[model samples]
Target: MGFINDLAAKFTFRPGRGRKEQNGLLAEELAALAKKIERLAREQYKANILAEQSISMIHEQRAGLREEIRAGAIRELAMGLAGDLLPIIDGILACLDFAGENESLRAGLRSVLDRAEVALARYGITPIEALGGKFNPSLHNAVEVVEVSDLPPEIVLKEITRGYRLGEAVIRYSEVAVSKSQTGTVWPGME
Candidate 1:
């Protein structure tokens, strides 16, 4: 009887003590789980911030690439148009050279040249100043060298074929005759 009563007491559920102990264990487990969840959330937030930064960088690069492509296409189109107009101008100039002494023909050719210049100006195409200017490799191609005692060496004495440019871009280089001094050095102003 005594052993049975002791066993019953040991196995018996005391609501106050048993429930409090179980609740404390449950609370500790819940706190641990909550801390783990919070840590994961913080890590995920940092990852998201890094991802957004990467995406922004990619977008900037893409925009810059698009701008470069657009500029290149514009340059190409301008060059193509200039290519078509240059030969016509050259032919007209040649005719003008041959039409000398015929006042009427010279006047007609002069009017045509004026009109062509105006049309080119409207499209941002302008003749590169070559004659009397210092010869630049970028804008001038020296086909002939003339030894001159009066003028500075490397000076452009004459433009054989005119150069044209659209905005800062040179479409064609001027074929020019440059002066060479007796000493064989470039002009003073030229580097």
Candidate 2:
């Protein structure tokens, strides 16, 4: 009996409501469902666009990191190669000091040295200023201390071999003689 009543209720309509009213209620429900579907589609589209923007940002950051790594590697390689080449360059300079009575040989060697300098110059390699200047532990390596009464202590007396730098970085320190007083104290009238 209970099942029969439930089945009758489903098939029957209200006392006053006709087919038109029932159809109106169904149409309202369909419109609400369609609106919900459209809203959800718009939200999904926005999410996809945000994801694409994030992916591109990540790609740009990765490219920047790669470029930084490459630049660092090249800097290290240039420093190492300069280390090996410096000894040879110093040797050539030493030979030039004793290149007397061989004018042609000396001139040829000078030209070769100049070319080598030009090649390294392309990479921003340059000689450090050492002689007749104040001594700096960062740029100058004190190979010998000269005892003098006239010059101020810590002043560079001589440069034994030239130093080199790449930009602000010291590739090699200048071998130099720094001044010191005979009594191992600060010079008189010198600050």
Candidate 3:
């Protein structure tokens, strides 16, 4: 009789009661839904990880570029300061030239000048060649003209005052005496 009642209940429909088979089916559906949610969560977690890595890479690149720019700016600032100090260097050179050629004094002056020259050379300050070269109106100022037979026309015979330069830019023009050929020299359009 017990077995018959159990079998009857399996085939019978109950209206207002919890059934074992229905509970099992509902639990199975909930478990399947939970697995789907877990899969989606895993995908989202991986995506977030990738995005974080990308952001970190971008930040590192930006930091490297920033450092390069800073280095470049510092180098440019150093060069500009050196350029401003050129005139002061020229003053030092002039002092050395003006001092008399006493051995002890000259030795002391030469030592100081040599050090300054090395520093200036590192910073691109160079002496302009003026004597016995072709006179460039741009770099040499003709304070006087003299007739000479040995030199070519318009050549620099003497540099009255030395000139200094910073790289390609002339800080001061060389004060010079330009030579005119003795025989061929004539006034403009007087030939």
Candidate 3 clashes between residue pairs 3 or more apart in a chain or in different chains? none
- Per-model root-mean-square deviation over C-alphas: 10.2, 7.8, 11.9
For candidate 3, the lDDT comes to 0.76
Tens-place lDDT per residue, model 2, 59-114, is 99999999999989888778877877888888887788789989998998899888
lDDT of 3 by residue, 128-187 (tens): 898889899889999999988766678898777767666787766888899887986565
Can you tell me which runs of candidate 3 are displaced by over 4 Å? 1-84, 164-172, 182-191
TM-score of 3: 0.43
For residues 34-58, could you state the per-residue lDDT of candidate 1 as single tens digits? 8977999999999999999999999
- The TM-scores, one per candidate, come to 0.64, 0.64, 0.43
Supply the global lDDT for candidate 1: 0.85
Clash counts per candidate, in order, are 0, 0, 0
Better of 2 and 3 by TM-score: 2
